[model samples]
Target: MAKKVALLQGNEACAHGAVYAGCTFFGGYPITPSTEVAEVMSVELPKIGGAFIQMEDEIAAMASILGGALTGAKAMTATSGPGMSLKQELLGYACIAEIPCVIINVMRGGPSTGMPTGPSQSDVLQARWGTHGDHPAIALAPSSCQEIFSETVRAFNLAEKYRMPVQVVFDEIVGHMRERIEFPEPGELEIIDRTEPTVAPEDYKPYDTQFGDVAPLAAFGSEYRYHVTGLNKAEDGFPTTKAELVDAEQRRQIRKIEDARADIESNEEYQTEDAEVIVLAYGSTARSGRYAVDRLREEGVKAGLFRPITLWPFPEKRVQELAKQTKGIIVPEMNLGQMVLEVERVVARDCAVELIGRVDGEPITPTQIMDKVKEVL
Candidate 1:
C-alpha cells in the first residue's frame, strides 16, 4: 500500500497524533497559534466516537480533561501563552491528583499577552515552574511539525505510563508552520494505556504504593471507587494533613520522574563529538541552531548543535559532559533568556556560556546563531 501523507500544520498534526494515541476526550478552549488543534479534534473526534468539548474558559477546559481522565479517557487539551497561565492551578491539581492527561502548549511571546501570533521560548521555565509547587513536570520541545506529531503521541505515553500529566510544548513558529507528514499506520507507533488495577474494587486505592511508585489507575465509572483531591493525600487518596504521609507522598511523586530521568530525557546532537563550540537550543530555535552548525562546519569551524527534545528534567548529565569537552556553548532563544540559565548552572563554569536572546516577536535566525558561534570560537 502507498503511504499516507499530508501537508499539515503543527497544531493539526498534534490532533491527529493524539487520536492515533487513542485520545477519546479533548477538552480545550481556542487560543491563537493553537486553535487548530481544537478545531481538528472537533471534526475528527466525533467520527471516532470520541468526545471534543470547547469549554467556556481555559480553566474549565483543563478541569474537563481531568474529569475525563479519571473516567479512563485518554484526555488532552491545547492552548497558547495566555491560556496556559489560566490553566496553572488545575495543572497543579493534575500533578497532585496524579491525573493521566496530555497538555499541548503552543508557545507565543508573553509575560501577559505580549504577542498573540509570534513565536517564543519564554515558556521554557514556566513549563517547569508555572504551577505553584515543586511538582514533577514532563515537558517535550519538538523542532518541527512532524516532531510535534510524534512528540504529542509520546506525551500521552509518558503521562499514562507515569500516571502524571505530560506536556508537549512547541513555539508559534513550529505550531503554525506547514510541513508534509507521513501518517503512522496502526501499530506503527507504540501506544500505551494507563495500567488498570487487577485488585478487587473494594480494595482499590488511587494512590496505592504497594503496586509501585506509579500505581495502576482505575476508571471513575468502573467497578473501582476511590477518592482523589488536590490536597496532599495518603495512599488511599483521601486528603491527609499528617506530616509523614504528606512528606512521603510528595517525595514519591517527585522520585517517580527523577529516578527515571535517564529514561525520560531525550536529546539530539549534531557534529558535537569533536566540537570546540556547542550551540544548545530547543523548539523552533533549534532549527536555526542546526543551520548554524552546518554553515560553521562548511567554513571549517568546530561547531555543533545540541537540541533537547525533552526540555524538562533538563538533560543535565549529557550537557555536563558537553561542557567539559567544548570550549564554549552558545544558546539562541526567542526569549530574553530562560534555558541559558539552565546551561550555565549545569556547566558550572566548565565552559563559557553565551546567550543570544530575542524577544521582539522575531525568531532567532541562523545568521544570529552563526555570529554568536564565531564570537564564542
Candidate 2:
C-alpha cells in the first residue's frame, strides 16, 4: 500500500530524505532557517540507528562528515550562511579527496551574518567556487517542500555514485515553509551506493583510475588498508610534490564529473518552444518566475521559464540553444546578479540578458518579474 500524504516543513522533509537515503551519520552546528534540518535530524537519525552529533562549530561539523564517510557510512551535514562560510575549507577537502557525503546549505542573506532568518540565493556561486581551485561539484536546488525531500535523496545517491560530495543547496523560503508532500515508494527511487574495492589487500590502489574514473572506496577497517588526504596524492594515497602526478590527480577528479555530464544535469522548462522571451531563474525565486510567465502568457506576451536544477555543471548547451531563438533572456535571483553572468557567458548570440535582482532578504515577487517581462518585451 502507498503511504498517506503528510504535511511537512521543507527542512524537516530534507532531514527525513537524508535518513531515508541511508544517511547514518550527521554532524552540524545549527543556524536559523536551516536549524530545523539539524534539529529534525538529531531526533530522527538516532531513532533509526543513525548517529547525529551537534559539533562545537561548523568547521568541526564539516570535518566529522568526511570522517564518517571514510568509515563507510552515508554521512551528511546541514547549515545556513555563516555556517556555510565556515565549512568552505572542509568542503574543498571533500572535493579534493573525492569523499562521498552530502552538504546541505539552506541559504539566507549573507556576506557575514547578514540576515540569518531571511532568504537569499546568494550562495549559488559559492556552492560552485567558494572552495579553492578548479574542481567539479554537483549542486541541486529545490523550490518546494517536496523537492527538498526528493533532492536530498538525489544528492546522496550522486555523491556515492561519483565518490564526490554533493550539495543539496536550498534557500530559506523553501527550507522553512510548510507544505504537503507525497513520497514515492522507497523501491521506486534509484539509489546509488559507492563502489567498494574488489581487489585483494595487497593489490588495492586507493586512487587508481585505470579501472575507471570511480576508484572503489575502502572502509577504514577493511584489509585493503590505505590513506586518504586533502593534499594531491598518487594511487597509493601518498602526498607527492611531483608536478606530473599532481596534474594527473586533479584531471582525474574533474574528468569523472565532466565526462559523465549527461547523468548530472537537469532542468525544468515551461512553454519554451513557442515563446519569444525566456526567464532563467532558480531556487525559491523560480516559483515567482514561473508565475510571471503564466501571467505574461495571459497578457499575450510570448514568455516562458527555464529553471536549472543542477546549478554547477550548469546546462550551458541548453542555454545556448535557447538563446539562439529567443528575443531576450531575463535572469531573476535573490542576489544581485550572480547566475546572470553565467547565462550571459553561455548564450551563443549577443542577445540582451536582463537581471531582476533583490538582496533585501525578501522573496522576488511575481509582480517584480511581471514588470521585468514587460520591460524586456
Which of the numbered candidates is closest to the native, going by highest TM-score? Answer: 1
lDDT of each: 0.93, 0.90
TM-score for each candidate, following the candidate numbering? 0.99, 0.98
Error of 1 at 66 (Å): 0.1
User: How many backbone collisions does model 2 have?
Assistant: 0
Tens-digit lDDT string for candidate 1 (187-300): 999999999999999999899999989999999988798888889999999999999999999999999999999888999999999999999999889999999889999999
How many residue pairs collide in each prediction?
Answer: 0, 0
C-alpha positional error of residue 227 in candidate 1 after TM-score superposition, expressed in Å:
0.7
Error of 1 at 22 (Å): 0.6
Top lDDT model = 1
Could you tell me which 10 consecutive residues in candidate 2 have the lowest summed lDDT? Answer: 183-192
In candidate 1, position 334 carries an lDDT of 89
